[model samples]
Target: MSINPNQYKLSDRTARLTAQDLLPTTVSAGTETREFLQKVIDILLDYVKAVNDRNEKVLDFHHPEDMKRLLDLEVPDRGVTLQQLIEDCAVTLKYQVKTGHPHFFNQLSCGLDLISMAGEWLTATANTNMFTYEIAPVFILMENVVLTKMREIIGWNGGDSILAPGGSISNLYAFLAARHKMFPNFKEKGSSSLPSQLVMFTSDQSHYSVKSCASVCGLGTDNCVMVPSDDRGKMITKELERLIMERKKMGHIPFFVSATSGTTVLGAFDNLNEIADICQRHNCWMHVDAAWGGGLLLSRKYRYLRMAGVERADSVTWNPHKLMGALLQCSTIHFKEDGLLLSCNQMSAEYLFMTDKQYDIQYDTGDKVIQCGRHNDIFKLWLQWRSKGTEGFEQQQDRLMELAQYQVRRIKEQSDKFHLILEPECVNVSFWYIPKRLRGIPHDRQKEMELGKICPIIKGRMMQKGSLMVGYQPDDRRPNFFRSIISSAAVTEKDVDFMLDEIHRLGDDL
Candidate 1:
């Protein structure tokens, strides 16, 4: 039976206290607050149970206006009662899509690790900034330990690293650090002080953040040279060398090369060894954006997917949130050289980074980062790592890869009804759902165009059904194809089959 929060009338708890009791004073409201908190805890528990329940709908669909009316989302001058607040919380959960659901393959990130969630709650309770050890002593150390572990996994013995807001910020940090490495004086004199046009290289299949970093860092987006990729989406080493030579001939300074361990749409890994060799030849700083594929490092069986020449990279961006299933916004950027982070982005403030603190000032990491006050993103990941030992994480990663292979096999069995984009290099399985009408048709441009048009239409129907969630995107000229990723260990072979069956049921008519 549903616990109707409204049934708990005001006379039940708050009425026991007077107006003076409600007001902030020396008196403690522990009893009332504890009762309210217990109710809130019940709501959270219910939400968690629903997320794990396969019988529950992935999302309760509603149009914008309807959702607004259903939620009764309105800000009031006066605070709401605890009962109304609980009711609102329940309503909010009713509409939210359960990304933790086994069948959810909508994005690169989805999973609810209970241990990590507990850490997240504790982190919220602590509510400390990660800037200085003076404030966030435990979290600061946790960040250092986590980052060092990541660097060691990348084969770096000692280096500088910082956790940023996201992978995009991490990439930007690499871009800025590379720029500073090339022209040390640019920090004080600005980009105009540079001798030549600054240029960076990344594969055309690389994340758009690389190009965005170029534009944000004052290097024109045009200067962000995109090297061609092979059919598998790995950067072509020969083409990269040619681009470097052409840029050098044109008097442009090639300062950075970003090698993606996992491309977005296809989950392709660039040739890191080759990319590193070219970077060395061109005297450019090498960065590996392993945001999506970095978790593979934990797996002994699949670590080779991202291991080759990773140590050669001057910097690497890793996000534990993606494949490792840490909470959101857990991204780290590492540098080969010590103190480069401080040299590149530090803005020392005496108020924060005081020199005469009794404790060791080396822990005052805020000065070395772009953001002054950072969130405590390390604890959840740290706690998760502690809960799931190194070997346990490796098993988790291996299991995910196995699940991906299982999905591929299942898709291949229904070959006439599906078109495999390519053999997946990682956990991402890309394919198009060929409807009955299009299955027997000749593979041609017209057929591709028809498939593309039907993808979104079918997607709309799927959304209405709310049984499962998956993402679709066009890879270059190819039509919009479904990209299913396996990130959560919670997803089983049964869920994979359910997703496939749901897609077929939704798209077969088209």
Candidate 2:
């Protein structure tokens, strides 16, 4: 069984080899495998550079059917050559959205942090599950430290936390924790065992995940009451109190109240202090969905202004991926009370959570989560935090806020061309770009209807042109309008101006 390393030389033979010839199979093909990986890395690095280049297109637009034809997406019965695989990687990046682009103000999660990227690559190379300290010892410790730091930033003296897959799952964790805390019996007997029908409240402008959590947690969507928001998209505190009273009078148990720190479209921070006062009086769990706005906690200036009463929250869901510029899917849910997560979610699978372990079995955190196998998402955030420190993150938040303000001011200055939706509290600047045909029209239902049509058309044009990528949506009261976000710290004031100028260029002719 002696193998000759000379046989795996970097010749035409090695170039023709497939992934099957690599490690864990043909160990002698180490050189060939390294060569192939190097090629792939070059492609990725080039893509990273291109995405950061403002002149480059945010994405190469392709229809679903067209994309399918463009790329060899099918899992073949046979593997392709090493060179073909490298080409495939390049092609995949070619058509994918450049979320890191400065002009790519499409979503809450955007940015390319080199430090975090390196951590993510290292995490993948490690390829270990974050179930137990024995398995992911370093990562488990890192998660604890990072989560502790985040809890401290939230003004919590001490707390428990877990990194979930995404903000949605993190929010779901909050929901589950609240439910278990309120009705511990519901765990064994199900929702049917509850004393009464449970109702949760969230602002109408809050992330839809709140309602989704309600549905998934067996609380029923109908019971998830939507508290109305004001013209500024903040939860009307008086209306919230009124709704809670009405729900109680109807004999439903008000168990959880989710106040959004930063709404999806409008980026409005709710009156957390007022909401906290109400939650205390009503004995409801106050969970702040700071998934989008949580990065503000790092800012000395905006933290008090935006998230004043976040410290009073019983639990909080914060996604570093959104504003902190961590890689996608870095979300954490923290609880003020310790052991609640374990008591609420632990199944104590004997095989995984053994009592006979020599080490402190308390570090075996697998039982504390709903999922058995969790990905190591903490490394990127931990590494990024190490590189940036709290002050770096604060500067990033302040810069994003400044860019948002610059965008708002630009919109107001060009009021003839664009209509500001509302004064943004976070980094979301919502507005309507008035095309030539719609300009100077009297503000009415007819004008609003016409304005709605502009966003879809301009969006299509921008995609076709491959110049920019911004999100557009219609709210309950307002018609379709651009909901530009400034999540990426890489985005600049110049980019903000480019966004406005490009919107005008694309939509000026109606």
Candidate models: Cα lDDT each: 0.86, 0.90
The residue-by-residue lDDT of candidate 2 on 1-510, one tens digit each, is 111122223357767888889986898877877887887777778878888888888888989998889777888998988767777777777788889988899999988888999999999999999999999999999999999989999999888999999988999999999999998988999967887899999999999999998889877899999999999999999998999999999999998999999999899999999999999999999999999999999999999999999999999999999999999879999999999999999998999999899999878889999999999999999999999988899999998899899999999999999998788999999888998887788878888888898899999999999899999999999889899999997888899999999999998988
Off by over 4 Å in 2: 1-11
TM-score for each candidate, following the candidate numbering: 0.96, 0.97
Q: Please list the residue runs of candidate 1 whose C-alpha ends up more than 4 Å from where it truly belongs after superposition.
A: 1-11, 15-26
Task: Give the per-residue lDDT digits (tens) of candidate 1, residues 59-168.
Answer: 77778887777677788876666667667766677688888878788889888888889899999989999889989998988888989998998889899899999999
